[model samples]
Target: MSEDSPPGLDLARLRTHLDAERPGLVTGELRARVIEGGRSNLTYVVEDGTHRWVVRRPPLGHVLPTAHDMRREHTVISALGPTPVPVPATLLLCTDESVLGAPFYVMDHVEGTPYRQRDQLVPLGADRTRRIAESMVDTLAELHAVDHRAVGLAEFGRPDGFLERQLRRWGKQLDASRSRDLPGVDRLRERLAARLPPSPPPTVVHGDYRLDNLLVAGDDTITAVLDWEMSTVGDPLTDIALLIAYTEGEALGDDLSSVASAPGFPPVADLVARYTATSGRDTSAMGWYLGFAFFKLAVILEGIYYRFNQGKTVGEGFDRIGASVAPLVARGNAVLEED
Candidate 1:
């Protein structure tokens, strides 16, 4: 691997670029602070005098192919601007690598706390928790309802091999990022390969639709649906399955009497029922997608395990990530084998 072009951002260069691009929008000393949690992209909240903006660029050291494309991320969010879906208004996109070390873009900085710490979620009580959960589901539905062609996303992800690419792509990612040997991953891969889910009409799929990925406003409405780096044209049900996997008996922990068990959540069955009723899409192959969703997440977390072992990641809980794989694989297989 080639040496990375240094890890820190060059503020002097960034100030010069912003001056040429927007002139008076940002003036004075540019303060750069690093934000955590992103593995593929380097994000920073750039504050200049009275103005604040967000910048997203490719990660340092090494990056995966087709990952962290700032232009693609800018395009999708900009396209979604006119839609009812909530997203940060993208201001400017710069493909000129000379401006910064790598391609980066600027957008309006949204002010809201993200719910990443499981213990910090505050439960929001039972009723509000269910409302927030439903809003998350509904927001995803709205995204899928948008016409890809009309929204200028017709050339997005390939529609033909949506499911196949997902299965193969994530499977390959696991192989690349694996730090330790886990036999269940192989077994799950074989089962998925043997009985691939039937193809469905492709719709917009948020590659990582989950609770933490969204921002909640009052009345349980989703003000901003973020992290569109993985958004693509694919089976809409795939998004549903991803959302369910993030919630189903997981967020609330082993005990069912937690905040996620409120009346509003509607369980997995109810969530799917509501989604099918709202979209009028076929819901027959939900089981396959649900299992596939877990498989994909397991692969991703395992990658985090790899990074953690190498001392490249922050936070705790890397060791226990491997434990979640077996259960997820079994759940996926059970869904496939069920009558």
Candidate 2:
């Protein structure tokens, strides 16, 4: 490992593995740099001068159970490749921990932009931004429309009682990362539990679906959807609600992605309606889903905050993450009250 290589990735070992598994794939020396913006899994862009690919792995330390599963991420991306959903073609799945000190996978490096902030979209004009946002919704619909059984993912995830399991899972996640008192957080979780909405027919759910999670081309088309660590076979509405929650980024904090605030971006109602019209899924119960989305996000942020305080996080902007948890809890309570 070179002195300058990122913390988790060892370029020398990576080159050796690629040469053995997919010989001649790396024609020259491998070089890599951590790709910022992700707070959970570590993403890096690796190149051999002539060929480029993306690598994904678990965070440095303090990994929570069932989170950042490289195999799960690799499986979903590979399964969705044949569908209309745009996922980068997977090249390899390396589970050997000795290779990178953690499980990691490599996929073709895609060319596109992940619009993370309002300023990034302002230059694109409203028309293009609207088109990109709508395309994101439509692509999600396409993903939900895919038959998991047909995609060889019949055993991917447990869809039955998915909502219940999700609430419980996040609750446990909050418990695991409990560092300080987060007022109203437990109440928010209890309220969500008390009013769990019956999920519709299950589909592949993108656990974290938002504008920034997608890669948009110059023509405003979503080239690929990235980050599938939390994806599974579950209520598709969770995906919608999470996307809407991300749009409410003001309540979360400035450090979080808030591309929805950009000029020309479609309103949340329009995006919901577009999904309804595109996927034919009833969203009448979206109020509950939205509240649950806020709660889930709060727990996620709290976990990140715990990790940040413990010095387990990598990259900038994590310092501002802890401040968002309380606001998110407040937002969730407000949404449920309105509902």
Candidate 3:
């Protein structure tokens, strides 16, 4: 695993926090095994004898506002407990600043391998890969099916102007954090703004829905959909668009490697068809949504590049991310112009 943080756990701080959260459980020596993969947060699998827990806190270094909100992270998973969505049970949230210099939350450590790149899913046959991909869709469908009001998510995000706010919010992030100038960021933003999708009924939108962000069981099932930090109530198509973006038009196919190969997984057309059948939402704007997804990802990657320049992050192939942004903006532009 990538060493995303300093070697070994912060033994003193870990013990202190765990002591307050679970009395007497902090006794004896405690060792922390860091979990890698996230670019914006610190996840560790903490162990003390027979007890095991997962602690998620802010990134190793400074971060921007609206990024890495542990409270929001813990709240969404907690709210999702009664829902059909599979989520790790939230155990405790520590807002005290002194413990680790930032708020952190502990939840039951879930067991499953992360399904990120096409390489990870290669062991499973094409049919199994299709099943896994469909399970991811099904989980998302069920999440969208939940009653937001009944689940106490009425205040999760403002319903009105949901689409407008998202575009505006991410636009600001792009402007605030891009290391280098992307060729068509401004043009794509302008075009996307000019031709925004029609707002539909508000539903939970997993701001980031991709293969890597989810965990899969050996049976090719999505046991848990991790990373709820960016989740909010908004246009449901946004989530579908995200899936389209990651899968890059080959959503449910075989040869699941690099997200570029084609053949086995369901194609974007079919994936959208299945989702439409399950979600019962209008598919008229799906093309527009897919364009928006591509554009949004480009902007986010550019923002990471921006952060890298400020001397915040290093490595992980971010230096070359600027190359991906222009194409994504162009893709968005094409979608808008074609429609």
Candidate 4:
């Protein structure tokens, strides 16, 4: 791909269509580049030499019908505009596949750093780091507090049987991509099924909530909570469990995406407590949720491994992803041992 053109985008055609659809949308020559490090959707930073914006589209080639719903992402961002979630301001959503070869949308590009490494946070010291971590929980509580019905998202997801559907979704994903025998996977899956906890009232769950997914400004405040591809109305505890599990893993020297192990970050209990106080949700049954989080992550990584095996994966780092599955399965089983 040339420097002038980003892969998966036809800038000339797109700009022409942009001007027709929304006049004056493109002030100058449009240029785009795929933002690296995103594992799922292809995110592009688009510019017109004056204003910058973000464009999101599904990855090229085969895709599941419901997986990369551009409309879903845009809808959620638009709904959360009046909420305290700090999502980027959405501009336009295009379902016309003729424009970008696939459905895509544009949003105002916010400035901030997604601190993915421990070294990046070390200079900030403990207090600032702790504040940032605390803010994450507060933001999550704020997000869960938003009523879907009030926000006109009552049909966003069927809250009934959410956990059961989630289990089946990941199970089928793992089976579809079972390239090897990960010993503890079946056992963990079975235990999760047999010991499923009754879910609390459904709230909008950010299916993949984590620190790196958020854009933090210099003041350590979250400028925008990016990435809502896995979002749905479901058990809010699932969101809490995932965050705790991620921080717990990082505390154990596991990098579960981001430098969550950095000094000054609050403990898992503290985060849960803050959420409980802020959102007034019961988290006593979190052990089961945390175990399920591990199982879900294992299944996800195994799928990536399967893609790598078929040589369908692009770029580096994929070689090391599949290896994390086994350990995650083991972690899943270990978490359940608390019961």
Per-model TM-score, in order, reads 0.86, 0.98, 0.90, 0.94
Mind giving the per-residue lDDT tens digits that candidate 3 earns over 55-127?
A: 8887655466687788988988898898998888888898887777778888987777776566655667688
- Candidate 2 segments whose C-alpha is farther than 4 A from its true place: none
Give the TM-score comparing model 4 with the true structure, all chains together.
Answer: 0.94
User: For candidate 2, which ten residues in a row score worst on lDDT?
Assistant: 250-259
Q: Global lDDT of each model?
A: 0.72, 0.90, 0.73, 0.82
Model 4 error, position 224 (Å): 0.8
Worst 10 residues of 4 by lDDT: 249-258
RMSD of each: 4.0, 0.9, 3.6, 2.0
Instruction: Return whichever of 3 and 4 wins on lDDT.
Output: 4
Best by lDDT: 2
Tens digits of per-residue lDDT for model 4 on 1-339? 234777677888778767887799789988888787666678889899999999898866545436778999999989998887899999899999988788998899999987667778889999999988888899999899899889989999999999998988888878877878899898898899998788888888888787878899998889998889889999999888887776765533343555666889787788989999989988898889999999888876676667667765544577777767777888889999985
Q: What's model 1's overall lDDT? A: 0.72
Residue pairs with colliding backbones in model 2 are: none
